[model samples]
Target: MPRFMGFVKMEEGIGAPPQALFDAMDKYIGEQSAQGHFLDGGGLFGTEDAVNFVVRKGETTRVDGPYAEAKEVVGGWALLQYDTLEEAIKGQEEFAELHATYWPECSMVATLRQVADEPPAPAEG
Candidate 1:
């Protein structure tokens, strides 16, 4: 089975009541799980509270909040396990529909990858 990373971009100022958003997300996850396509998922805090880091010229720079954007920004995401890329895409589409109900401009993308048996190690010292 392949794993997919789903990045969900939300419309600006489409904030839902916290409880409503949580409830909808829970229902969405439950539906996906029942369909055997849900693996794990989480919602992140607003971009203003997120930390963004970058490495350049052998130096590390940390920035508060996500990079500047002209349009929508990622509000949350999920990881899905599926038998095929198509299946993962189907799941993403479903998620998009659910998000769209609250965020008309929400956008989603799914990237499929094979899960490795072990985590990769850092470069040798």
Candidate 2:
């Protein structure tokens, strides 16, 4: 099975929603995990608490945010293991559907990236 990292990107300036929204998402994710589609996941706070570090040459400069300037920030993430990309896509579609049905006022984008497997150790001669 291939593993993937799925994340939700929330539009800037949107504050956290009511606990009911979180409860809905948690229930859905919990069901998936029980079915083995979800490995682990959690939500994140708004970007006001973010810090950005830019490294130029060997020097690192840190800037504190109001990441208000960002267009979108990851609001949550999940790890999934699937037999194929199609299965992963279908899973995300279902999740998005849940959001559409339960959190219509929310604006979010969901995306998935495959997790690379670790390489085998070099042969010992």
Candidate 3:
């Protein structure tokens, strides 16, 4: 089975979503969990309190967010596994549909990307 990393990208500072959407999402997540497609993941807080450690020029520097340039951020994520890409696409479609039906006012992107089986080489000092 191939693994996928699913992300929900939405504009920053939008405040909380509607209760109906949350209810629908709970149901959807429950179904996916029962079916074994939903792995480990959850929603995230806004970037106002986010932190980053950037590596540049052989040095790592810490940066805090509430970043001025950030337009969109990941609202939620999921680690999913499916037998094929078609199956994964179908799953993502159902998820997107739930959002479309329950949270029609929001603008967001639902991304499903295959995860690499192997990690990249370590960076040299």
Candidate 4:
């Protein structure tokens, strides 16, 4: 089986999702979880209090957020597994449809990426 990570991105401070969307998601997630596909997932808070430890050259710099420049941010994520990429895509599309049907007023992007199973090769000198 292959694992995929889904990131839901949207504008910061968007209003809460409707109850209908929540209800639909709860039912959908329950079904997927029971089948052992929805491994883990959760929503995240706004970036106002987010912290960043950025490295440039040999120095590390700490940055805190309330990022004025960022128009969109990752709002939630899901860890899932499927037998094939096609199945994963289908599952993700269904999930995205829930939002489209229930929360049409809000714009969002749901990105699905396959998780890397093995570590990458070492960096060249």
Candidate 5:
């Protein structure tokens, strides 16, 4: 089965409702993992916890955060395995429903991306 990454992006300072959702989500993940629908997932601290880096033309330039765009930060991610993208998408909808039900006031976006089974092949020498 292929894997997909489902992520949650949110602005900081929303407060307790998201934390409550996370608590519930943790239990949900454990149950899903037992049922073989979830592989792994976790919550992340705010963007203030990040150290940003910019790589341009192969030169790496690192910067300290508090990132300027709080809205651009990703709060957490989950990895799920499924036979098809549709199954992965439908699996993540449960989390979306949790958000809508519990954290309606928080600015949040949930996204999904398919994970490649292997890294790209190197070019021939």
Candidate 6:
């Protein structure tokens, strides 16, 4: 199965009370898990508190936020496992529908990824 990362972008100033939002998210996770598609998922605080870094020349450029334009900013994400891209897309669509019910203004994006290969065997100590 391949792993996919999905981001749920929240509308500006649309955040709900933390507990309420978390409860809704938990319900969604439980539903997804019951369907065998949920691997892991969670919510995040506002982007200003998250970290973003970039490489420029030989130096690292550190930024304070996983910031983005208001319309495209991500508020939370989930990681899921699926047997095929079609399954992943289906899962993403389900998520979007659920999110729309609870968060009508939000949008979603999903990226498919394969796990990286294991590192070469370490030298004997």
User: Which has the greatest lDDT?
Assistant: 4
Assess each prediction's global lDDT (C-alpha) against the native: 0.67, 0.85, 0.90, 0.95, 0.81, 0.68
Model 3 lDDT tens row, 27-47: 888988898888878999988
**Is 1 or 5 the stronger prediction by lDDT?**
5
lDDT of 2 at 77: 92
lDDT tens digits by residue: candidate 5, 1-125: 88889998887756656577777777778888987878877778876767878999999999887877556678789888888888888888888888887677876788999998899999999
If scored against the real structure, what TM-score would every candidate get?
0.69, 0.81, 0.90, 0.96, 0.85, 0.68
Residue-level error in angstroms, candidate 2, position 62:
1.2
Candidate 1's residue-wise lDDT over 25-118, tens digit each? 7888998888777877776666667786889999999888644672666656677788887877777777666655754444544334456647
In the range 1-125, model 4's lDDT, one tens digit per residue, is 99999999999997899999999999999999999999999999999999989999989999999899999999999999999999999999999999999999888999999999999999999
Ranking by TM-score: 4, 3, 5, 2, 1, 6
lDDT of 3 at 108: 90
Q: For this target, which candidate reaches the highest TM-score against the unseen true structure?
A: 4
Off by over 4 Å in 6: 17-25, 66-71, 107-125
lDDT for each residue of candidate 2 in 1-125, tens digit (9 for 90 to 100): 99999999978666567677678878888888888989988887777777889999999999887775788888889899889999999999888877777778888899999888997799999
- Candidate 3's C-alpha runs over 4 A off are 120-125
What stretches of model 1 exceed 4 Å from their correct place?
Answer: 17-24, 66-70, 102-125
lDDT of 5: 0.81
Poorest 10 consecutive residues by lDDT, candidate 1: 103-112
Q: What is the lDDT of residue 101 in candidate 4?
A: 99
**Candidate 5 TM-score, C-alpha based:** 0.85
Clash number for each model? 0, 0, 0, 0, 0, 0
